[model samples]
Target: MTTTGKIVIVGGGVTGLTTGVALLEAGLPVHLVAAEIPGPTSVAAGAMWGPYLVEPWAKVRRWSLVSLDVFRGLSDAPATGVRMVSGIEAARNAVSAPEWNTLLLGFRECSPGELPTGFEGGYRFTVPLIDMPVYLQYLLRRFREAGGTMQRQFVGSLDEIDDGSVIVNCAGLGAGELAADDSVRPIRGQHVVVKNPGITEFFSEDTGLSPDLVCIYPHGETVVLGGTAIDGEASLQEDRVAARAIVERCAAVEPRLAKAPVVASRVGARPTRSEVRVEADSRSDGAPVLHNYGHGGSGVTLSWGCAQEIVQLVTATG
Candidate 1:
């Protein structure tokens, strides 16, 4: 009943699974316990590798870059559900390139003709687009192969962890309660999946200025059209109106999406904060605990980087 010598990790989403892999690689016995695997949130993500809404530019850049490399290595491994796809991000105005742009393949400013009407500028790059369900399963298989253990249950708080084990909290939004973090809140996102209309690439626009999402992520026979990032809202109910809006906007960008039959709708509550927490802390009794959550929309994009740092923190503090 005790995992005294094991490194216990909470959460079974991408973050926790990725952490388990990294910890096992660092030669540590791992025990992962979470309420869900291939979690409700991550499974609903329109997950592409872009540092969209995470913070601390320097750390985000570093973490995203490391993850980019890791994902690229997995691109050819079809079972992993990762693909290197070219996409365009249209900006209403000119902007500087992202710091991690140097790490992507074929990243460059878009040509004048490439910009859709009303877009002043944009950039095209090839980045890793993840099919979360498949990728999460792959992570689970890889974790077990590395000799890690997992349990399906709810953890009330950090105090429940075994006394002699070093704990890593990759508990995503649940960290709000587990770690007493008031800063962590949900940024609700929704996506609509449709039968692919033979679209071969991906497309997205910054939804900050716009009131709705205009994006399309074609994954083989199923193309994902989304989405909505309504901050502080965590409801998972299917919003027909919102789904309609997503389809309409995406269709305006890619006409084929207008006719693709709606296959499904997904919802997720992303853990958002001013910045990601990837540092070592302690419990009331001074037991070592390392936090690795608040990744917002960049959980997959920052997974390996944060996991690598978690390993370093454990090595230094263990």
Candidate 2:
């Protein structure tokens, strides 16, 4: 538990911050460097617990289950901006319960009336819905309290972070350049935030297999409507066309959304890979490194577990 060495975490989104905080709390000196920490992407996440579109389903399920419990506990802390909300995932076709459903709270098959029209089958469950901006602030606060420090610096390469500790690469899309990972591409996502319209629960149509994206997540006084997933598109430019489509599609699920006044619109490019890279690497000089990025759309879902894994990996050799 002593300060074995200084750990440098690259990237400032959920993954980087979570890993940095975990390592710092484990009594290791940690520092974070990033071009945009808590940048557009992490803040623009739909920020749900579902393991949507993440590969290597086994590992993702394990990580997601761990994060679910952690976020559930954090829900009690007002500043964490996490809450256990019950919601129904309506599927256009019949689908069996996902294996990971058992790990969640209040799992149930929805009755016909419980389902929104056009969804032939669905399930209801309670999962952690995070208000990302608040949660990130809470994470930064906790990390500072744990003696972690951050620098707003850009890292052109891992060698630039050689400060006597293994570098943990949570650099997200930058991995395409930072780690020279060509497999890492961006899945651009957009969201529409509107007045809550008194919606208390959440609703999402499982469009994972389909191209259409439709979801309504109500957090307090606002509902986060989402989204689009266009692969290889890294543009952060807001698309008014996409925004209107998101609202129109979301309104189909919840009628009130049709008249809700639009509050804001945002965009983010999810760093995606066929499988998330969470393993050890080495430099030409054999300097140890840990790669943990390319989470696609499930960074929030897998943050805690992956962060904990980073801690274990560091401790095993520290």
Clashing pairs in 1: none
lDDT of 1 by residue, 214-284 (tens): 78898888998889888898887888999999999898888888989999999988899999999988889
Measured by TM-score, the strongest candidate is: 2
For residue 70, model 1's alpha carbon misses the true position, in angstroms, by 0.3
Question: Could you tell me the TM-score of candidate 1?
Answer: 0.95
Best by lDDT: 1
Residues 51-75 of candidate 2 have per-residue lDDT tens digits of 8778798788888878988998999
Clashing pairs in 2: none
What value does the lDDT take at residue 50 in candidate 1? 91
Model 2: per-residue Cα lDDT at residue 4: 73
